[model samples]
Target chain A: MDRVSLIDRVSQGMKNLLVLMLVLLTGCAQQQLRGTGDLGVVIERAAGRIVVVDSSAHATLGTVEGLGDLSHASVVFSRDGRYAYVFGRDGGITKVDLLTQNIARRVVQAGNSIGGAISQDGRLVVAQNYEPGGIKVFDAETLELLADIPSTFGNNGQRSKVVGLADLPGNRFAYALFEAGEIWVADLSDPKHPQLTKYCDIGRQPYDGLVTPDGRYYLAGLFGEDGIALVDLWKPEQGARKILAHYGRGEEKLPVFKMPHLRGWAVAGGRAYLPAVGRHEVLVVDTSTWQEVGRISVKGQPVFVMARPDARQVWVNFAFPDNGWVQVIDTLDNRLIDTLAPGKAVLHLEFTPKGEQVWISARDDNRVMIYDTLTRKPVGELPAQSPSGIFFTSRAGRIGF
Target chain B: MKSLCLLMCFSLAMQASAQSTAEPTPARQHELIRLVRQDCGSCHGMTLKGGLGLPLLPDSLRDKPASSLAATVVHGRPGTAMPPWKTILAEGEAEWIVSRLLTGFPKE
Candidate 1:
């Protein structure tokens, strides 16, 4: 070949190489996130929008808007994964249709309903009215207030700090009081008039609690004790049993850590993982034995804990300074696999019922992050306003009020 | 008697030299200016206008006593994020910094 022809060929090859490099760089830059189920993971962006991405990690799905800012909202998917119910800390409860990606209806509830959890039947949505230390039952269909259970148990004046809520079979709900150090079991059998059956004291100011799959026992995190107390529901009179103490690995033999500040926990595969904020470590407790099996240290003040049951992987949210990243841990190996930087104050992560994907709330950035569960890659970003809490839908298309 | 008198004279001269060295000089003033621009300016703004901390300029701390300001710098106010600097800074250095903060300039 002539020299000029050879030079032209080389130039073309270089252009192709450059293109390939660009493609490779873009592919490398994209993060791997898991989806909760067959439906793409839906993330509530703090920017008052929602983004949905499918499981294959291909195709950017859609963007929806109209969630308020600074609300620290929590989104729960309906049973069929059709609609997302958003409850904000600043009194904004919105129903977003996942199919259309639109805010169907918005209503202002009482002050600072930061989080809400729907029952298995999806008829009642129980919201924690933060300031008053109580749970407000709203008609899941009408979004109307049905009942309010106040912190009327003890002499403690302020409303008990109600941080989390979980649904049990039937119309029963277990709510955690962050300040009052008690867990109240309520029967919403009659949605209009919910009754608090009994109170089990956990420890000094219990922050949150997690129940096992069998629903026989509840583990509560003591913000003060540097440990968690186990509650046996079958025997409520036994009170909360202080099971595992101090991250399972402290030289002092006593609780040297001043404030354990347990913020988030995940229970699966007969093991419970609680992120102790003051200790800056994740404590893994075996549910069957009721003992702390292991501990993993991470960055400052981890607040939200999540795990994929099939994958044996756990993710934790560090509330400040790199707020949107999660520390991934391999439970089988009991080692930190990687630090997932999702960007912008990721305060919550929830898996779909099928556990195919995970939805994340980018609280400060106002968006939700959808990740593919298997690859753990970012598939999409959803717009939301200060979205913090997340739950799955009751049904594919059911947009709860 | 002669040796004692010579020792006393030498001690007096040494004390005078020490006082002279301790006295704030123009070089020390320049150093304080550098510190104000580098250390104090970072948190309190380029003009010593406070952001998270109290303002260091004369207009912001107009009637505030130098002693109180010095005390604050040496022993940070408790129940807040401010940390005590007694461990970090020496007594004289703290006093100098506080004096500069209060007067809006170094002791010149």
Candidate 2:
């Protein structure tokens, strides 16, 4: 070959090799996703970082840092559970690659945000904002802003604070307005052109809410009212109805030291176990009938009431002063079976997919505690900094995690 | 005699306020600063502008009496999400927070 022809040929050969390498890398990435769903991320709140934990292996991987304002941070995993979309209080949405323990794409989506949800189809991600209150949707993969729906209720030109945003079937998002006392369903089937169905007068001051695991109901716990506001997403025309009206009604209640998070409602044995605000108890609701079935008295004001994967038992945490304890309730007999003091301040709980074990984050102790749910004994621990929320990727497939 | 008793009661109340708002030590002050900026910042905004809770900016709190603000921190606002911090914070610490909040919270 002539010298010039040889040079051109070599360059072309290199280009072809690059193309093949890229194709191979993409294939490997697809293969790696199969095991990624077993991964989990722990929120190092005081510090802007997350410690990736391998749930199946029960080991700490690495820490991804520099995501801002995680004081009240929460995370939702991607459909494949490879990427963790971290929602920061400073209105930042960060997409982190669990395998690499690095931030893949990060964006300050809003001014201030509490939490967010991923659509069932995994095509869209929506964040519920507190400032200039509204919901903003973005492309799941690219984090591109697709739609913006402000929480302007009734004739008011101003937006109201939004809360309790959760993902639903049919590419829809459900959230409550704290000031407007309303619930809005954002239909994102189109992704670009979104439609909203409003359920007005949904009790009052919905501090937080969540969708049932079966994706049939959306319940918001009211701060302004005594009971929970429920919506039958299957029947959007009926709007919302108040259930457990007299749950805490007319009773002399303790001063709520902290707002009980309603998102942690645990569904086990065909019943919903929710922490009652200002009450040292968990309200058991029959999901089929939507009736108040019973109440299980816990150690203190309940914070997180979570069910083991097998739905045989439920775990409960508490607000400050009583925040250092974790209580487990038996689903079969519906009684408090055990109580474990994980550490100084037991903040969050997460169970491995098959319910073989569970992880708990204790903020004061600055460590993650693992317990064998079945054995009811201490298993392991991973050191972290001011950890508050622990999220397992198994949650990606579950509704309203 | 009655007038003197009332004056003495007023002086004692003033002393309590003064004692509670007594400037914290530099180390304790740093912890207090974080408490307002992180724990309280969870809802009030890291910069204290506002989020789920209303703004705690100097401008927003300038009009609010420091005593009332201190009381809110100590006793908490009933019928609202603001919980009583008496469990974690002392009366004086709350007073200190009120004073700092009124005069622009420290960034650090």
lDDT of each: 0.62, 0.85
**Candidate 1 iRMS, in Å?**
12.2
After superposing candidate 1 on the true structure, give the runs of residues whose Cα lies further than 4 Å from its correct spot. Answer: A1-46, A52-64, A156-158, A246-265, A322-325, A339-401, B1-108
Q: List the residue pairs that clash in candidate 2.
A: B20-B92
DockQ of every candidate structure: 0.04, 0.39
**How would you encode candidate 1's per-residue C-alpha lDDT over B28-49 as one tens digit per residue?**
5576565454344323433454
- Top candidate when judged by TM-score against the true structure: 2
- Candidate 2 stretches greater than 4 Å from native: A1-34, B1-38, B45-47, B86-90, B104-108
Angstrom error of the Cα, residue A80, model 1: value is 2.8
**Per-residue lDDT of model 1, residues A1-401, tens digit only:** 99999999999999999999999988766533433344443444335555654434433457666655322455665665666677755556777765555677777775545467777677877787665568888877778888888865566566665755666666677767765677787888888767675555666756556655555676666655556767677777786678766553454222111222232346657777777645567777777788778878886556667667464877777744445578788777779878777777566776665567777777556667778766889878766555555544422332111
lDDT of 2 by residue, A39-110 (tens): 889998878898898887778888999989887788888988889999998899999998878889999978
